[model samples]
Target chain A: MSLDAATKPHEQLAEYLATDMEAVNRMIRARMASEHAPRIPEVTAHLVEAGGKRLRPMLTLAAARLCGYDGPYHVHLASTVEFIHTATLLHDDVVDESDQRRGRPTANLLWDNTSSVLVGDYLFARSFQLMVETGSLRVLDILANAAATIAEGEVLQLTAARNLETTEEIYLKVVRGKTAALFSAATEVGGVIAGADEAVVKALFDYGDALGISFQIVDDLLDYAGTEATGKDIGDDFREGKLTLPVIRAVAAADPSEREFWTRTFGKGRIAEGDLETALALFAKYDTLEATRRDAVLWADRAKAALDAVPEHDLRQMLADLADYVVARLR
Target chain B: MSLDAATKPHEQLAEYLATDMEAVNRMIRARMASEHAPRIPEVTAHLVEAGGKRLRPMLTLAAARLCGYDGPYHVHLASTVEFIHTATLLHDDVVDESDQRRGRPTANLLWDNTSSVLVGDYLFARSFQLMVETGSLRVLDILANAAATIAEGEVLQLTAARNLETTEEIYLKVVRGKTAALFSAATEVGGVIAGADEAVVKALFDYGDALGISFQIVDDLLDYAGTEATGKDIGDDFREGKLTLPVIRAVAAADPSEREFWTRTFGKGRIAEGDLETALALFAKYDTLEATRRDAVLWADRAKAALDAVPEHDLRQMLADLADYVVARLR
Candidate 1:
């Protein structure tokens, strides 16, 4: 799609950050290359070139520009953010045993799980290498902790996926780890690298954090809302036994018969044909999907509110709109 | 197996670094814990408590002390090195699909490949966190490059493992990646963190590089030298189709009939009951086993020679002796 056709806030942001984004893309290509292992680049290329929005890297660029960063390190941080995001996607596909991502075959399917795992590792290492080039230990510290949190969230999801006892609190923690940690880190490091004051850095973090949460909640809602072109099919999360917010809320409000259905399908892993339709019906009965959507909107509003702490700028407005655009996709 | 009877040079080094090693061990324990994912500690403890030599961390500690560094960051660096090593072992077990390590069932075998992969990733992230705490950009750079090299070596090995056309040069590259990269980084960062001079840092890097190469060659040699307690059984590498030094040498010297045999067994993956015996016979006929042993000794001597540039110290002597001790076990 052309920039003129770009309706999403992130698409417009990508257009605005196009030049710096190109630099980040170039650095990604250069860093992902390996002299000894040709497979590393091959696998990385499959995912990197899959045409998903460069939203995370764009956040880094946006925050840096908002803080008036003039040096080359912001590009480095942007690339670092993308590498970390791509690496996690590779590993997540393996963990989820997924075949399709971004409407294309996953690396594990195109190559093998082994390639996906090792290449993900290479990118993660490369990400660290890029972050160290910024010469800001605070940035490194922020990004490093985010990396650890991302992995920890994935591990937590592994144990929490099939359990009916999973609470919304735990689900929020997982969502934060899987989505928001990188989001917040991507933006926080940008401000920190630009030598922005603590207030602005903290504002960037809060904004990204709220935006990420809203984005993921919408994703969970859309899995039930049936958006297959995004490669996330209806019942994909349900079949995977993931206790996302909608299901967690529905289960909490479940009657005895409804509770038995959830227990049989999700808790006991005895999913039958047409169970997805039944789960959808149950979600409708309790209005949990609408409830989840309301939560997402609230988070997006919080994200926009956090932008108030920063000085007024065009990038800030775009970021505020970006948060709104996340939940806007739902309607 | 009593501590008093631990006659390996590494064991002696461990004794010398006991107090520091205790601190390193404590740091490892503290850092590996995950409040959200109990599975992380369970899987990590399986490998961590299995009584490894803690050799890589010891190298870091030794290098730091030998450079007159009495700072506390060395402990963090040492712990970082060990975490990276432990993390690699976890992922290696998954990549190799191994069932046993160090005479115990592997984490992959004990828990699952999923746990191994995720927990390995967690430890990797944790290691980066620890390294960044050192606040030395150069140290971060060295460890980051080493981590990338380790992953690249692994990916290269994945692509290069079974091909009959794999050469000695490729084998050396893979060996450097899988074994020596971390070793060299573990020591180099120690000196770098201690603010050692250019010559001393280069010497430490050289010592670690040569020592790691020697260490791996001997491990490969011992696999066929028939030591079972080491958990690397005879023909394990052959069955896995790994082209180590002995097999590379044997293949290089094979006659037409032996060529067909090597091609069928390793190249084509048609190993049979008598294949190990035949492979051993071929090694004996060409004396490639002894030839590999000689190569190991040469590298060990090179490792000892690298220490000449550094000032003489008790730890230096222990490191030199450790090189000799790697191959000594084979005899």
Candidate 2:
């Protein structure tokens, strides 16, 4: 996990996307400023300056490069994808009533819920403007679909917050809607507007979809393993009654005692102390965490297969590395 | 102000819009519903079904018709305008932390702030999708610009909240961004997409802009003078310390002691229970309310003049009447 190695995949991604995403970051910080709204700079900067991997925007840039795009609009497209991602995160924090994001206080917790809502809106509007500047109706189409999917996912998460009957299929759909759809959209549109042929564009889209699926599955896997390194507390999902992939599998495979335990914990939505240990024990008993890790690797393999349709290039290899990087956490 | 023979103009305009806006209303309610996100249907229905005049959509519908549009896309365009408006209101009530809207419990108070933000996002995303379906880049430009203006206005309002030194010009900018830009965009895009000449489209835009200015000024006016007619409390704006058109003008025109009272009340965000009366008396003493009313009428007159570029038609006449209806509250 250390950054000392020069040949590390994350480092390779950093070196690959660094030059362009630096520009993307600069644009984000510049556009986020407001003459009238001083709080805008503070709240947006808190999240923007936070150490995210920039994987989504990097996917966009990589996709466009793979499609042989030589246009400068890809930078804006990259920045736009990031804005959509950032805006969703801000609103997600508000909707989830989350205080900690990346181990720092959330915008809503630091400011008020009103600032979070309005600032999220400002970012959304800014994304729209950035997309329009690209002058690519196809890209707009793709991103607009992603935005709807993201909103739908957030709403679905709200309704399913305390519900225990949320199925594996439903969970997958929600995860796709919330995370993978945007990942795919960010990549697919880049290939699309670059005039890539139908095969390559669709391949990029599928690759992004699978990469995102793997990315999120690994995240859910980490949530169960107690070794979750994503800064968020491992037990938050259980505490909040969120049934991710591991929990869904565990519930499906539960014994009588396990069923009653889940009913008392997730269904009732109030877990006493050490319920985390009990849930972790159940996960171990059902081998759900290991199974979830295998699922992540399966998605990563499918994602790599998706890229077989495209010609090999440095950027393309980097994308393949990213797919591998998604499942690297499972190790 | 009574809905009698003397107010035939308002009645005529209402019937005119009611008849023409049928398609717009149908599309809006249908499109607002989502199969996956039931919260959208729930929260949207709370506000969409809340009885209110559909003036903004009417402006859009009339603009397209008066410019001799023969296409069906205007129906979608009008719905786009309303969707954006409703979406903002959903968010605005949450930001304002209001308890009631249109005599019913606000969505935030009823459901939660989370639902308000998510549902507002749902509608906004839905609105963008609907506009994208229209396939007119010009229309997208118009609506997207309006979205930016609306967000800017919201941010400005947030920054200006409880600050009393905000000038009349700043108030106008906030109101223009918050209200007028969408109103103007709704109409302008209609004419633009209808293949109206630039001059005619500009006229429609001007008419809508003036009408919106008049509409908002009259709304501020009603905060002081309206009874059961406007349905909202008469002095909520005063109580909220919103430095609207009347208050901004009055503050500029106040004497030294009155200025000190105004500064202490608004600048410090502190007020006694009867401070509303004191503010009202100050507004009266400076004739700020009456001056603002006159400004609304002047804009109404400008609205009528802008439509002169379009040829005489029943829809054009109704649009002019609608402009008058927006200013009818001043009487």
Candidate 3:
């Protein structure tokens, strides 16, 4: 079953991106190592080494390279992205009280929430240090703003956990804050630190932002229909009572009986067994997943189109493919 | 009471310090204002306006000025220190499950643990932003390292809670990480940003470290013995099952009856109503409070001596008095 060497996913990437992604992994491993605290390394390794596709840092590294960055600090930027992402995951698990992530016991489950929290704080400190090493005040500003936005998004999500009144505008804001903010910032800073022109930086930012919106939309849909390769179980968003895009659409299409079911499943205390199936059927009946997929493709196309306004290069081609890859699972 | 016509305490030396502390306040108020997210200003202002003694930031302010550095960036350093201190306090209240802090409702109590944790993170980000504006890599390094140490110390305290086997070394390590690290770093960076010699930086660090240690010792002692001005609700530490230095020493000095009391009060959750009185009497019987006070004075003296190695100035004399003030209530 071994793939032909030419057909391998890593081999299939355009030459420079393959190299950049590899470089990002190397930097993450090297920087996350610490001599001061064993618990830090121990807790962080669970998320960092969990093989979660390295999508966010790749956005950063690729943007930096594409923008003609020759400096060595892009590696640091990539590592900072991963660190921030990991810190959020650590805190997210605690907030969600979820015992499993990536089919592995969460850090909160393995080591108490206290350790997860402290380790998350430690990673944040380390991220700040890595960014400081870059010696770009602009990078610090972008990253700091993104950090605040990410937390706000998280708190917004926390508050919006059970409410069914989540409009598309609020959802987009949450997505922008929680997911798109960092994704866009990662690329924005990439173009920023490379001394790119303002136009190029803005394009990279818009491109990243669109890609992130599409990526998150697809994720919300797939939580009701994704397979094991995606590392998410079907109906995760539903079971967690998250009123994501699919549920939003489905709830709009819900009839009176369906509304009762929704209330019982998400709002009321009685979560009977087979609720996921009923929810999925409702989603299919409303064609919400399909609608969601179309939205993802629309945004993905917008993401690629945003890049068309930027100066073209091999990295631009890779970025186009990367945007496609973000929604690849949706189709 | 018209004593202002004459010399106030530390007036000869601390008059400038008094002026500088005012400057730190102005900076804190200014930096904490944000126009983007109103919640940020609200959450940050809660702790910033809580009327703390402002000891940590004052250390930064005093250290920089004492070293003959008149740079305005010390205001940034002071604000950074205060932000870090505020962030830690927010997280500590959550970790300690505290309802009241300084006779006021804790952030966790007023809001929730989620808000407290998230807002603490926001403040941390804001603090980094402030430090980055300083444009001193050395300052960043010092503050980042101190932040890590502070988080580690808090983690140590979390894991050490309810454990009776906490040794003196562990206690000191915890205290240094939680309190002394920031104090030392605040002073160390003050000397650093001032372009002081390494010798002065190290001396200031020692001064701050000893002062912080003395401050904590006095705090623990005050929990066992002090009047309202010093904010002692006697034996509160015992009621919390926190094994302070005096309590640890008293446990070591306990007989069979006292051993039973220790096991029941601390090891088990059977602390009776009068257990605090009994614990205070045990501290008195073993003279552990007096011994702890003596230890505090020793550190205070060491803190005063740390300045002697540096060149003498009015601000230097004020730092000596500040150290005295930290331990004065005990006398």
Candidate 4:
């Protein structure tokens, strides 16, 4: 299958699920509004309508459809997933103090950190409400556990930031927390909501988890080797001194002077001119970026393999393609 | 009915519920622990063990006991309330840029904002997990709505801050959001988990709602008329330009010059020396402080009256006394 611009897996999924996607969008807008707090709607609209890929919610919808669900509550679940994602982004921007998100000024930068924090909180509560409306205790359990894991992963990443002792184990845990937890929950909840078989649910969860890991690894990789096509500024993780997977691996294999270079840039947060180039040189000497790409590819493959348990449908094929597309940038 | 130091309502209730409170404390300690992130417990302990009166959780326990709840999950519910409270405080410090909470340096001040935000999120998720453990959908629904109301209230207060046009209705809404929603939820969920009858649960809800309103009104009033006994600095709200009840009423009754003062101090956030005194004098001129005090007393009375539906018990009497104690500072 020749993957063209119009044939991107996510885009294809969005088109196939357009009616359901529209319902999900409507539900999101309706729930995000506050009868009392207009700021809730304003801040939520800023992010929700920002045209991000809506990929997480799509995962939820696709998994439900693929599981042969024809229920109404999948819309609620999809909106719940999106709200959680948006809440995390709002808080993440405040934590990162980043001025830009999705090519626009962030809520924290535009409104205030107070709005970002509180509005993020409002959306979290909203998401909780939406999930409860599904009336699935099992679904609630799945999302609640995911919420805890996401929070733990974030705190782990924060504590691990710029620390040379950060291991790949810690990095993977953070990746699971920051990205894959939600992904797995999104897919797992769909299967659970549909009353899918246990094995099928497990397969959905595995697929989401692997795909999320692949997605995050690719993101981290792009911060180093990205072109303009990725819409990422190269070496952002380096500039922030983030101890991502590549850096953690390279540091593990570093000699004395290279260790000193890592210590200066990441540990103490000092970056001189041409530091990006020097870091790239170090990554090259270590081939850690290539190793990171391989890791992403491996997870993508694992994601595709996990789908073997699912009943094969066009949606299932799209999901497999989606997994492949996540790591296809490396090729 | 002379309230002695050792016989304070909360103190007496604490003694009565000591065993359950201990269990709740244990649950809190156990749940707040993160296997991956140590920062969760550290930040939680700083606030949780800081010796702030556990008034909110006590409401949950007292309500449960008063309604004859003998189950183990009331302890879980009480701890859930506290976790939600602690989570809000963590986020509140970051939102308010607060340094001191319960007379100790805040978590945001001690660690960084990232830890506070992420830890707050962790506690929120932990609270969700605890509530889910009870396996009561009604309890979950009640807490979920409370969470939404609380968030909406905070956002409304944020946008309404410094706006002189903020009405008493808006102040009441903000008060409910910041303090009362959780209080009522704490009490209401207890009755719910106990499987109390609808009337008793409604009574518990009303009692908590009125008590929380009275408690917050008194706290706001203390910001103007407080002494050493209240542990509140007089005019802190004025210095912060907050639009609490007394100030809102005073603004409503202000003449052109008084309006100018308010516009300068609050609307423009340009507070200067003697502003607090002038604001107090204006409150006196309009009798708004005394009026606000009356509002607090009325709500306290309402809280006591609402307990009429609750089965007569010693805990009920203590709860009534707790309401009185909240507004006792005015006298």
Q: Write the per-residue lDDT of candidate 1 for residues A22-55, one digit (tens) a residue.
A: 9988999999999889999899998899888989
Best by TM-score: 4
> What is the DockQ for all candidates, taken in turn?
0.61, 0.57, 0.36, 0.67
What DockQ would you assign to candidate 3? 0.36
Candidate 1 structure quality by residue, lDDT tens digits, B92-168: 87666632233346777787767888888899999988988888888888999999999999998888877888998
Q: List the residue pairs that clash in candidate 3.
A: none
What is the C-alpha local distance difference test score of candidate 2? 0.80
Ten contiguous residues minimizing lDDT sum, candidate 2 chain A: A95-104
Candidate 4, residue A108: Cα displacement in angstroms equals 0.6
Write down the lDDT of every candidate, Cα atoms only.
0.88, 0.80, 0.78, 0.90
TM-score of chain A of each: 0.95, 0.93, 0.90, 0.97
Q: List the residue pairs that clash in candidate 1.
A: none
| Clash number for candidate 4 | 0
Candidate 4 C-alpha error for residue A87, in Å: 0.2
lDDT by residue for model 2 (A248-271), tens:
888899889888889889888767
Which ten-residue region of model 1 chain A has the weakest summed lDDT?
A95-104
For TM-score, candidate 1 versus 2, the one ahead is 1
Candidate 4 lDDT by residue in tens digits, A131-175: 888898888889999999999999998888889999899999999
Candidate 2 Cα outliers beyond 4 Å, as residue runs = A1-5, A98-104, A226-229, B1-14, B17-20, B98-104
TM-score of chain B alone in model 1: 0.95
All candidates: TM-score: 0.96, 0.95, 0.82, 0.97
